[model samples]
Target: MIALVGLGLGYMTPTVVFDTFGIVSDTTGGAVPSAYVLALVVMALTATSYGKLVSVFPSAGSAYTYVREAMHPNLGFMVGWSSLLDYLLLPMVNALIVKLYVEQVFPTVPSWLVVVVYTVCTTTLVAITMRGTSRVNLVLLAAAITVMAVFVVIASYQLLQGEGAGTLVSTRAFAGPETTLPLVLTGATVVCFSFIGFDAVTMYAEEAKTPRTLPRAIMLTVLLGGGIFLVAAYVTQLRFPTNAPFGEFTDDPLPQIGHLVGGPLFQALLVGAAFVATVASGLASHASVARMLLVMGRNGALPGRGLRWINPRTHTPVVNIIIVGAVCLLAVDFSLELISACINFGALVAFTFVNASVIAHFAVRRRELRTAGEWVRNAIVPGVATLMTVLLWTQLHSDALIAGGVWAAIGLTYLLVYTRGLRRPMASLEE
Candidate 1:
């Protein structure tokens, strides 16, 4: 549910939610589709390794569990810490997006009030998350899917009417910004966030009704989500003039697109969809991150013993969920610039560790494996993806790098204290 909220609607319809971040053909230099395709390819290789790991070790911690089993315990701890960095910081970006849309509807409202309101809404949702995951997520999913469908209808209808021809372009003519490689890489890093949620399915391995069926679901979701996003991006570009500043479209790109192609109703629906989409992301991020923390706690990586406490009534990790919620609310107070930068920094680190985990797993099993084709899935693909993530990290701001470094430092400090005090020998490989 949380992953669905985060990556489902707005990810594909980035034009509707975060148009300022440069994921569309017009703003990103006509290479939005290609960027997504590239992301898909990167994830596909990683996903193959992920599929094997998840099937063999279907646990709640997702990637961390895989890393712990396949590699050194300290490496697992690092990946778990990195996963927390990704989840905790991403809500800052989401909250900023929410604040922008809120300010759009009530332009006279103070920006601080918008931030406060967004923080409150996300926190309230987090509070409710401790109660149970079912009721709230069901409602959010319904609303998100409905809003997406409405936009699709409105956008498709407008296209049928032969309006906004200048804004839309043929796929053959698509050429993204012919800028310097660094600039393009920076933009591509931003674009990559849209494709991050397909892995969320692995996190829910424990709750899956049919665990074996999940690999197919993950693949299907990625393909379907990617395809829909491609169409949405093209249609959005066709409707809105490309030259508009990203800041102008940050609040409600769909309404602007609606105004250009259709009318007021479409605009209203688009705003509604954007809000629902943001809500979905917040919820999913909440759930997934909390689970990662719980897994970390269970293995003694984190200090709090109570982090593993599960609610008997709700069957949820109450303490972890509350902590994640509080952190996300804090993120709302931050500037969007910081939030976006933080997300890239955290995710890149986690992706790097995940690729390393895959490589280690394949190496350990190489002698046992008879198949000649295992190298690409286990070794070569993971290597390239890891390099790509590390390269992307180089393009991030120094502040983000510093912030991520600080976070890692803090985690390492905590781990060091725990290990020394307990005499656990954590840095050394554990049998």
Candidate 2:
């Protein structure tokens, strides 16, 4: 979970978020950092609600069970659909990032080759996941932490040289620009995307050898991941204040930062380190997404019988793994920013529901007023975050929003078909 969060935050947060915000408002203005800080505050509030929910229901179906028990069956399915989209979109985003980097290092290589290589690498990781999620998670955790340590080391050295700590302390200067409220809100929405993957921890509840332990892990992952991103962003600005287009720096900022800290060897290490981080995150994503699909299948929301097929030798969800892999591969056809936006949309939708679920879950419990506290902590903050997310979605380029809307509409239609065409008949058979 920590590694996944780190990879998610480290790769997605500082760079992409900054670029999108800059492009939209055409501002390297004072609001970018403020927007990031706002996103953190909002995420902290919603994380508390999610932390509590995960504590209560440590099932593989994190939101699946939470929405069902807290709200209604239809709501749970809706959460499932949104989560599935997030999971499905993430690998594509990550793969596209890798492709961008590969192009930077070897500009001559065809982009399609990079996509194929990424798919192959991810598929091999999925095959390994067939053994056990624990094993895959362990490797991912190690890889993620190792890469993060390298970043910390590089950043630390730069700070010591009086180069990378100033930005964290000094705010940017802005004048003459019309700093509109809607623009700030829109930037905050984009910043929200950087913090999206922390919830990957919740998705592992079912397979988590011990469910009770997951809440802590999930919270720890968020706290740690968020810290890393905050530091990385601050340090990046201190070291490279130009706010360079992410497309230009797509190869690896760490290496450039590493060169500033040390030299060529250090830069190479950082690139290699980022690769490990990428793989760990990619593998964790594969495991979590496959399980969600498997759980949905088992519940008969999907064609349970076929979708639940596990590899006899490995005891893993083979069919679901392949299906997710294929979709991720298909997503590679789109640009990285598009994939990231879609994932952000899906995750924000899930976060909103989870937070609302917290309030609903706590409201009916008569035993303690603690439940009221949970309601405020879980529901209210996430509710605000949800609104911010919607604003961000609206602010997105129309074509991107249209694509996301179409994907969501299709999922809803699938749910309707499942209910009428699948579930009602299953109920009749039981009778």
Candidate 3:
């Protein structure tokens, strides 16, 4: 349950709910529902692959560990390096969402101030203890789920009363006159960002009471979270078919949707809930980033000893938490779209490798040891996931592709320099 909530709710922020509505509407010509359905299917396949890997190698390093054990250390380093783009930028994106939500409620508050407050608060909350962070996240997730449930009820009531599209049941959100296959695919690629944290459940495998249950938990997390995301997108599209009102709120649309359904008081409550959700997301992202850095530092893959230092009382990497907070301070200048694209790019790349890792581990190396069922579970399923993720990767925005490329190039450079032109290993093999 902890894995499910942490991975599912941690990524399904209110900002994601709104931003996806706008982005998918722009790309799919109002067929937001179909696009979300496509993304959900693709994510479900990817989640299946992650589950297989977790069952085989339940470790804290996530893709980094899976790829290294299955394939080679060099490729594993690249996968981990690519994942840094997602892990490092997620806290900033979450902080930006909080800033946007607060600014929406109190327009006079400066963006810089909001960013500072969010970063400081989130970093402090995360640096305290894992137990405390989990408690806070559970509370925030419950509140977010309640607010969304109310939203769905109110939106359904409004639709029944001849508002917006003037119909409670319509295919307009799933298919419009202008909707095309290419457009829906583009929207699906963008919507894939909302599913980023589903794989994060694997990071907690080492601590799980029964490692065998993690695979089922991963699938449930994706299914439950994806269902909520699809419903949110569907209802939001129904409420605002044209996507024009979203122009006023490029960062958030839930508050506006709340206003349309239940007036200003409800809108304020939704905004407050959204703020809490963003903070929860920031805490989760910050903790993941700190753990990744700590793992890499312990392996001597990172440069500094700072990331390796853990406080005895707290059992937390204080220096890495501080560093992540400092980086999040730069969130004030980044646009939501750019941040979304880059994050999706990095996550997609890492996911692609995870799929490949499964095939490499199960099919090629242990061909004689596996039954047909195991072969299908380990190879064929992940192969489909690889293909789907690669398709989405091709559909990423140009900015995202370029940014990811540059980040990858930098990682390659570090690997080459650190290993003296690829002649030596990147991390110690003793572990």
Candidate 4:
């Protein structure tokens, strides 16, 4: 339950919820609500496939472990390598969004300073101990969910009172005059980033008390989180309406909406909640990326000993935490669009492989399941998810494709050199 809630709340960050309005609007010509709905459907299917994989493996490494066990170690290495872009850079992206929000409230402060302070603080919190970080995450998650609830109530009331759109019910948010299938798909691709953390639940299998129940937890997280996202997007879109371009308020739309519905005080409160939420998200991302690094290191897929080093006192991978922090410093130089695109690219690629891993595990390799339900769960469901993700992948920005391709090339090069042209097993480092 803790993992599910954390993954749900952390992935549904204020930046994602608010900023996505503009991103989808720009692409789909104001079909923000429809984009979110489509994205949710796709995510639900993908999450179902993820659940099947977790039931079989019940282990860490997420997509890496699933692919390695079901397919080949080399393919798993590629997945892990691609995943590095998602897990390692996600904290940096969160930190950057936090800095942007801070800049909105205090325009006089230097952005670079905000980035430095937030990066240091988040990294310190994560490096201390997993137990401490988890506790802090729960508190922050509660706060964020409360803030979102407040927004929904206030926004709905405002709409009922004929404030923004002067009507409670409208179809413009869902199917605007300019809406098209391609545009909605494009928006769906971008909105897919909002669901990135669902897979992180599988990475916690080793720590779960009842490992067999993880599949249920993964599906529940997606359903619960998707519900929150759909409501948030719908109400916010109604408050702003289809005619208003979210681009003008992209830097900080939630607070802008907060000010609109309540007042300056409410706006300030929402901003504070957003900061806390970003920190919570950064903490989770930091811990997850560190664990992935530790797993790879222990398996000899990475620089062993260094990343695998766990602090005896805190029982945390301190070295990997520090490395993540160092990588966050690069966030100061990149734009939010570039960072988000690259991260989304890697996550979608990894998700594609995970869906494929399910097929490899149940239908092709094991061939143990003979019933219709088993085939639907193990083959048909994942096949649909694979098609959806690949379609979404094609909709990604050119920059994302180029960056992901370069990263994949680097991983292939390493595999060739490390495995001696695939003659020996890729786990050569473990020996």
Clashes of each: 11, 2, 0, 0
Total colliding residue pairs, candidate 3:
0
* Candidate scoring better on lDDT of 1 and 2: 1
Could you tell me the lDDT of residue 292 within candidate 3? 85
Q: For each candidate, what TM-score against the reference?
A: 0.83, 0.81, 0.96, 0.95
Ranked candidates (lDDT, high to low): 3, 4, 1, 2
What C-alpha lDDT values do all the predictions have? 0.61, 0.61, 0.81, 0.81
Per TM-score, the best of the predicted structures is 3
How far residue 389's Cα lies from its native spot in candidate 1, in Å, is 2.7
In model 1, where is the ten-residue run with the lowest total lDDT?
A: 9-18
Misplaced by over 4 Å in model 2 are: 1-32, 130-168, 173-181, 244-263, 364-397, 421-431
The residue-by-residue lDDT of candidate 3 on 230-344, one tens digit each, is 7877877787787676568744566676676788999887777777777777887888888888888888777998989999989899999999999899899998778888998
Residues 1-431, candidate 4, lDDT per residue (tens digit)? 76555765675564467755665666788778898898888888888888888887777898888888788998899898998898888889887877777766788998888888888888888888776887788788889889889888888888898877766578877877788999999888888877778888877888889887788888787887788888888887777765354346664465566676778898898888887888888888888898899989889888658888989988899999999999888767786767777888888888899899888888898884699898898888889989998998899889989998999899889888988998765672232
TM-score for candidate 2, residues paired by index: 0.81
Q: Output the better candidate (3/4) by TM-score.
A: 3
